[model samples]
Target: MTTAYISRPASAPLVGIGWMVAAGLCFVGMTVLIKSVGAALPAAQTAVLRFALGLPFLLPMLPALARVRLTPSHWKLLSLRAVLHSAGVGLWFFAIARIPLGEVTAINYLNPIWVTVGAALLMGERLPPRRLAAVAAAFIGALVVLRPGLREIDPGHVAMMGTAMLIASGYLVVKRLSEDLPAEVIVAMMSLMVPLGLLPFALPVWQTPGATELILLFAAAGLGTAGHYTMTRAFAAAPLTVTQPVTFLQLVWAVAVGALLFGEPVDPFTLLGGAIIMGAVIFITWREARARRAAIAAAPDALLSRSASGPAARGSSRG
Candidate 1:
């Protein structure tokens, strides 16, 4: 029950929107850097090195991390999360390097859809008929983006699909761990564990990145970490209704970056599908927040404590 989060500012909604936009920008920037790295190094090696290089960023959080005491259950969940996250990182690296950033970002929107289903089934969160419909619409959005029959589906498409599912799986485990642990402890553990989980995969196909690639990947990793922090700030500052839709701005930035810098074509279908998926996610989040508020209102004393168990407590997963 150690609630570790920033106090909400007076102008909480405005501040939350700003933080959400900043988080989206950081994630888009990270995507650009990862794309710039290309296929020079194996995806697994790049992911392993990215986390390894990110170790320095954890230096400032050392004292907080050191104070943590985990139960055996936390260790088991953490290990499972590490495996999911490690695989996700590798697949994401592979997809970003091969696919247009816009499409990649659009397709990645499926993470929330997957999470919705996973949470209902595993976390015992009730998914009503409407929520199930929303989830279905989100999958349709993925179909709109992929349009499988229209074009040959490449390995990149497959990898990105797997990446979203794996990331959702990791998020589910993190939610379980968050039941008892502070957000910082879960992040610190994953920072270490994901690297270890990735090491064996990296060793099999490792190639030394050039110094320039190393620097770029390091910067990307930093942005990824900062993105997570900003996302947490957004959730802490205001309810999901105010911040969730703002994440769509990332699609705009990703598309712009892809075309402007990489000379990639602007894909209209990606944009449309991204909007579809984002709309579904926003609707789902709003419904959850509204329901939680109603429950809190009915029995404030009984449910107020449970409110802390939400995302504001769990923090955002790494990009």
Candidate 2:
């Protein structure tokens, strides 16, 4: 296994936090742009164009992708990631047209809850009592955010939930791939695959965008790509525990931007619910980091103790 990520620096935590904040801002911008574009373009087409315009950003990383050797296993998982990611992008674009931007953005927080459940069930990761509690808390928070009983549920809500689930699945695949592939390779593959996968569905509804919408589209592409790049940097810089909570800032930015730029209303319930989810995610992330640290600290002592006692035990047996 590669050790490229083993000796991460202490400053990584700070850098990761900053990068995650930047990523959140960029994504908030992307969501606003999608709303501005409205429903004139097909959701699939918007998704495809967003990625197509972002393709140039991946050019410098292609050689890094080329250098990495993909195992058959990695390829299979990457394919799965691409499919799930494509679906998520499509549904999220659809939601942008139908839902308030803040609500749409807040709903995607369910991705972490799904990832937690998935890692336990699919990857067989140990889920202790604390993590289980964290999951439950996060789920409750999701309920508050949805408030299904309070208002009529729309197709937009369903689409956003589905997008979250698909994104969670994609995350698991990427986690598996991270063991063997560089982050750059994983990112390059995603940038390349999203447009290619989205194209067939996008083609039928292709429209000639006006100058204003065209500018928004390009800006959207920039935001989306920059968001991913900064997010990758966040992971590279610090442990997930350090950067995970920072993502909640996206919700704040979404609400603010939606209100100021688009005149969307800010709901008190949404803020409360979002805060609950963010708290749960932060707790879960912190617990995971603690577990990892304990494991790492124990490993070397275990090896040393085993080595030190081995020859003595052998000698005593001979006597």
Candidate 3:
């Protein structure tokens, strides 16, 4: 067991950085696609189309699933994650169709904050003072983004908030299951399950998409698939602490695209709020990395002490 633990390859911090880049690109592209669909396409239909087109990329992974084994607990957890992820997708699509692209992207950052809180509450993970403070800072940033008191909050904003919460919860669940399953299996299951779950809702108002719409839909799906694949590779190579900070780049990309592509205005408040959220998130990740390093350093010494106290040592002492 010790040998196996020791043999686990070091996940490079740079890998995490790469994953962040991929994720940023994927999300920015997704937002652009959503904006292109406009209010003409039903959010549900757009979501269904996104997943449907992405299905092909996952086909090759189906065979790998056969080699993989899942425990009952893993199945249950995966099911929960699938549900949460699907709902989050639905909510996000609705929010994007209704809200400004920059605001939507800014609010989306709340997921990391929610994940931190969920980790503490659900996973019973320890949260030091710095993390707690960071969480508070994040919440404040979200409030600024929403600005509920100054403006009548749109239902889409609420939906986006819900989306963030659901995705964050799903992430914590994925982290719980990461030790047992390969990333591909998890990604494949999500891609497959999203369309399956959306089918019922999609059938109600199924509109035949235009040729241009179809092309955009396919492109969105392809980007999403590729983005996730790159993200997985980065994560596999690096630690979350290294990747978490780079996700901010996505916000920048989204803001630029929103302005240039969609004629969306960049609000100063959004920038300020986003900065607060990013700062808190960075601090939280840094603290966690430091704690992880300390733990790893202490682990070997603890193991050696235990081994030195084995029964053979008592026999030698008696002799």
TM-score of each: 0.90, 0.91, 0.89
> Sorted by TM-score, highest first, which candidate order results?
2, 1, 3
The Cα local distance difference test for each model comes to 0.90, 0.86, 0.84
TM-score preference between candidates 2 and 3, better one: 2
Highest TM-score: give the candidate number: 2
Error of 2 at 177 (Å): 2.1
Q: Quickly count the clashes in candidate 2.
A: 0
Q: What's the C-alpha lDDT at position 283 in model 1?
A: 89
Candidate 2 lDDT over residue span 81-188, tens digit each: 999999999999999999888788778888888999999999898888888988888878877878988898889889998999999999999998888888889888
Judged by whole-model lDDT over C-alpha atoms, candidate 3 comes out at 0.84
List residue ranges in candidate 3 displaced over 4 A: 1-19, 69-72, 236-238, 308-319
Report the C-alpha lDDT of model 3 over 1-319, residue by residue, as the tens digit. 4454547788778667866687789868977986798777788888988888878888788987889888899889899998899889998999988878878878888888899899889888888787898999998998888888898898999999999999999999899878889877988888888877777877898898998888888888888777777777777888776777787788788788888988888877887788789889888878877888999989988988888788788889999
Arranged by lDDT, best first? 1, 2, 3
Best by lDDT: 1
Global lDDT of model 1: 0.90
